[model samples]
Target: MKNRLLRFYLYFILYLSPALAFAQADVPAGARAAALGNASVTLPDLWSLHNNVAGIANLQQAHFGAYVENRFSMRELTTVALLAAIPTAKYGSYGLSFSRFGDELYSQQHAGLGVAHKLGQFSLGAKLDIWQIAAEGYGSQKAMALSVGGQAEIIPDLYFGAYAYNLNQAKLAAFEDERLPTIMKAGLSYRPYHKLLLVAETEKNIDYNATFKAGIEYQLLQNKFILRTGFQSLTNRATFGAGFIARHLLVDYAFGSTTLLGTSHHLSVSYLFSRRQAS
Candidate 1:
């Protein structure tokens, strides 16, 4: 019975992957980003390397992060991610991020290099990624993709962003007869009150219905702690999360649930060479 279920799961993921050209990744970006219902294109931090490259400009010092997520409480479905970034006043910010999903039976890994630069109130960024997909019985394949993003501060506390991933629609493998999805995203983030933030975004893909995401984060205890909640339209899921900060160390936790997919839990830890300033 377990064998049958595993086979079914593997085939399901494969169908959603190369065959359909869906851009959804098995490993999500980060717990904090996930908590924002993955409406992270405008949010910045060390993990922005995987979320939105332009947001990496928010980093003022070197940063490192580790993240993990469990989907439906399955070990083989767990995801692990690592990220690092260095920001310099002269050259802007540079980042490297990697993530691995699944076991040997069916696994995928992503390695990415990204850079972001800020000019006045505008930020521009780009990234190159290598994706490796392996199936125990099927042949493994590798592909490279490129992404670019930009963000502008319309007002002091309001920001607008645009991002596109796999912009060239890279082919998975010629024999596979599939092309990567070209996903375009746009969003705005606003801070109505000193301690409250709100974000909304829309994502479009050629093969899938457009998705709308919205999230809110509130700071408590003078930026040492936080609370977040959000919702996604396509999956009809709600998410809740919190963050704790101590000196240069950070910890984040998130929980998400859908009608059909049960629940997912995520945790992330990160460190910044210099602490962020409070809003």
Candidate 2:
């Protein structure tokens, strides 16, 4: 088992190297749309598992969510995520999350298990991701990756975060090398009041260009409905989304336009399980 794991890691590193080496190549324009434009990453639900693992650590309850993104001129992307957190006397709190990303033609699934420990005024966390990819005409492959992230309270209502993904790569198939994309991201979030959140994030990928995202979330109707909007520079697009929460369930939808293509839409649903009664 040890040897097999080692070999898998090796292959993963090999496959990913090419993409990094040729990082300058113009990546498929459509793929970029599928990536940064994903609204699920910013939503305050199970979908946050893949958007920012650190967000899941802050969740007050266990939640599960599924999302589907329809990208113009490309295959559909589907994702499902689960998040859970528990507080402990000795460890502060710990969180677990899992997510999958795939399309009809080719699919990639990522299962992540994570833990967060609060240190002083900051929270630190790490995630281990099990990755599997399947191609319609080719055999399936599996690999492993690791990520570390942290969130710090800069002030009473301001927070800062940083995360690194795919620090290590594992081999998944013979003669077919696939290396995970290494990414570094930093963001600042501010809660001016109880009902509003403003966020701005910048991300850098070893294999692609950098992008900036800014979003705002507002609550209405005594916190029963939420509205969100954001703009991304790399894709030169604006996104508008809304969410409805009733009891322990939340449903969200986002709409945006792509410069190179047409419009795109995303839908997500989440169920939250709280030990204590929800407010």
Candidate 3:
């Protein structure tokens, strides 16, 4: 059974994943982003290190987060990640992130250092990533890539965000100009009420068709609990999730389903510590 599953996974990677570009590099990191259909370009949170680095410019406290995801209920397809952010009241924010996906047969790793700075109502950020791709019995390849992002408050309660992954178009292999996936995303987020949030985004891969996504989130009990739901167009997936907050800790879980790949489960935990005082 394991062998068959691994083979299927290989086939999916080679044939289908290109069409679902999100499966490749720059994958969504946290459970919150997954639960929200990846409409996270405008969201400001820890996972922003992987989504839109600029979003982290809003952080006023130090944060640490860990995340895991089991794709299609397969251990071989699991992904694990760790992230940390430090904010300097006068200098802006800095972050570190690492994530690994897949099993021994095939795997990908990303380690990145990022920085973000706020300029009045607008924020800008960038990350330098060290990436490694490995396949059993075939060795591994390493490369570096740069990513940049920006976010701005367009109005009192609305935000606009955009990011470009692999801005330098780093090469993965020498053959046929084979390179890491380059993707672009833009989105809007609106907070019509203190407790209600709505998001919509469009993503494009240089080699694939554009995709649309949207999500909604609601907070209850004075911000102690949260509920979220979202949809993706091209992938035809629906996602649901909830979050709980206790003091400085946050826990989130998400469930996503698709006709092609079955169901996936995602979970994450984050802790906030020490707010930076304005200088």
Per-candidate TM vs. native?
Answer: 0.92, 0.75, 0.95
Candidates 1 and 3, the one with greater TM-score: 3
Candidate 1 lDDT, tens digit per residue, 1-279?
997787677667765565332343423488887898988888877877887899898788799999998887777677899999988877789999988887767777888999999998988999998888777777777888899998889989999988888887777667656766678889999999889999999988766789999999999999999999999999899999999999989999999999997899999999989654444
Writing each residue's lDDT as its tens digit, candidate 2 over 201-274 gives 87777667888877787899999988888777877988778878899877778777767757777666667776
- Best-matching candidate per lDDT: 3
CA lDDT of every candidate: 0.83, 0.60, 0.89
What lDDT is reached at residue 78 by model 2?
Answer: 38
lDDT of 3: 0.89
Stronger candidate by lDDT (2 vs 3) = 3
Candidate 2 whole-model C-alpha lDDT, 0 to 1 = 0.60
Report the error of model 2 at residue 266, Å: 1.8
Q: Where is the poorest 10-residue window by lDDT in model 3?
A: 15-24
Prediction 1 global C-alpha lDDT? 0.83
- Candidate 3 collision pairs: none
